[model samples]
Target: MTIEPYQWAVRCPETEAKLAIRGLSKTFGTGAEAVHALVPLDLMVADGDFLCVVGPSGCGKTTLLNLVAGFETPSTGTVRLDGKDISGPGAERGVVFQQGALFNWMNVLENVAFGPRACGESKALAHRKALATLDMVGLKDFALKYPYQLSGGMQQRVGIARALTNDPQVLLMDEPFAALDQQTRETLLAEIRQLWQRTGKTILWITHSIEEALFLATHIVVMSPRPGRVRAAFRSRFNESKDPLITVAPDFVEAKRQIIHLLGQDANKEEV
Candidate 1:
């Protein structure tokens, strides 16, 4: 697929949006004690688009994600998936958390198969699906190994495989690679880019790393500090590049610089 260059404000047509956030806001508590975690914000994610969200700490990035995941109710407005309002969690969305969150007692295969089994698939069918998904993540050989037996990166891959076994339309990932070493994180970033291309799944990813966001996202949304809102949104093509050195390319560097500048402005405002 030929990705277009970055545009400062690229809007996905309403008809093409797989996930739509309209006037979504989240406030904790009531009255004077209320803490606005997210300000009313709108975003549209086109089908098969890899959208990464980045912002300062306490910027409500996770709050926005939770609303879409239907884990929390928005204080105002709604999140719609394929034109249907999201009332609560459903099978259509698969979430990968910061940690593996795998069942410690289950081996890799069992861990990955748990989702399918829960959805009423037969034990045999669930195992088959899990094995295939594990193979997709290059973990077929480690299927029998326990989570504690695997490295942190391998554990994360298992989490991803588990998420894919359900064949979800959208993948919601919250800093899935944040705990890994630099090298492992880079490798997984490349693998994830390939996985997204192959699966063509719409992804809503939350991250603190600007470079990771720039490299993995087809569209990047930078949010403002506290009561977070969209500070800037850009359509980027860097995710299309297969070259390992693409991150160091002049354009990629410049894009990173621009995002840094935007975050710097937020940082200054945060200090005041």
Candidate 2:
């Protein structure tokens, strides 16, 4: 299979973007002690786009996600969701962390229902929505179980179901499957892709696994090491394939190889 060239220019006009980042940068501390976590970067995620970010450690992938999620203020630049500036965390954006951040005291159903409940929905309505969302993640039967009772994979499913219950316009995930075993991670990857297809929600995912990004993202962004910047971006076709073994296809392998090469270069830069 012939490989298509990577698209280095992935930016789109703000008018057409579902999530837009412009000249975004973040710095911690001050003066000589200051740490530059992210450099000025611009990205545009269109509606229903699955955009995955990959890079070497300390490349500010999580920093960028936090900024977009409104968990932290940027040193400069702006993040706009649906043309409105994100002042802070809002219902329109739902975040999933690497570990399942469910409340241990709450059962799976209550944990998933908490978001809607916080938003002032009646308990009856919230429980109904939570049950429906749990069903979507194949965890309806586990509703009465507490986080401690479920396996790690099942807990993560609860995290995902919680995020979906609110019906957010954008989903922000920070290496959400990093803690899972390979088999479980792969299972969730396929499930999440199907979920995305079914919901048509825009997603911004950060993952260190190139295979995960290739298999799940419609667009991939590679960031350079520390003071992270967009080193390269590509529109991937592998995500469109339904075959489980597509990862081994020549073109898929080639695409992965190319990203590995880019990341290798970024590593070399960090060492120098």
Candidate 3:
């Protein structure tokens, strides 16, 4: 794969931002029927930052992510990547949805390789990249298996692998582990952490689990109930620690409690 000069240039530590969302807001429909999904919100994502967004059910957490991924256009404001306006989806940003949207007709390797090949990589090179990525997600042995043959967690792994095959600078994950059992979710969490450390990719993750956000994010943002706006933003150091017992640490517990309290306050407002 030929890496463009700009792609290599972006990896420079001196670069200030990987993504910039300025007064971004989204609304669906028109007139009285208009449904405002996101209020004007501004955010800057530094290179290699793991940003996790959490909020109540209608708080537009996924809407925010979709904007960054260019899956939806913002009704107001702009989203820029490396200083350029993002008008549509590109290989620079890869996305992993809540469920693995794999093609049942294709085997695991083919599914993962589909992206690279679609991007014009030679079949052999794409297959090689796909296999390497499968190995990263710990699914190398299942390369030939079809989607139906794998469990839910395994399918999600393939979804992750497919996204990685593009070597995207940014990863937008929308509750990728939400469908899994607790055990499988925890396992995938560790793998995702390792992958982030290894690749240093910029990630925007949307999850409902505060514990999961604290465990994975370098930065966290909590949105208000609806017409979602950032109610709070925090920088967390817990994810940097290697201690297995860190989750039980007082600081971690306090942070989680604080976030839960914040969410609860907003939820109460919605009820009122």
How close to the true structure is residue 118 of candidate 2, measured as C-alpha lDDT? 100
RMSD (CA, angstroms), candidate 1: 2.1
lDDT, each prediction: 0.90, 0.91, 0.89
Model 1 over residues 150-175: C-alpha lDDT tens digits? Answer: 99999999999999999999999999
Best by lDDT: 2
lDDT of 2 by residue, 82-184 (tens): 8999989998999999999999999999999999999999999999999999999999998999999999999999999999999999999999999999999
Query: Which residue segments of model 3 deviate by more than 4 Å?
Result: 1-15
Query: Pick by TM-score: which candidate is best?
Result: 2
**lDDT at residue 252 of model 3 (Cα atoms):** 85
- Candidate ranking (TM-score, best to worst): 2, 1, 3
Write the residue-wise lDDT of candidate 3 on 1-272 in tens digits: 01011121243332467788888999999999999999898887888999899998988999998889888999999999998999999999999999999999999999999999999999999999999999998999999999999999999999999999999999999999998999999989988988999999999999999999889998888889889998988777777888787778887888898899989999888789
In model 2, which regions exceed 4 Å deviation? 1-11
Q: Which pairs clash (backbone N, Cα, C closer than 3 Å) in model 2?
A: none
Model 3: residue 83 alpha-carbon error in angstroms: 0.7
Q: How many residue pairs clash in each candidate?
A: 0, 0, 0
Clashing pairs in 1: none
Model 1 stretches with alpha carbons more than 4 Å out: 1-11
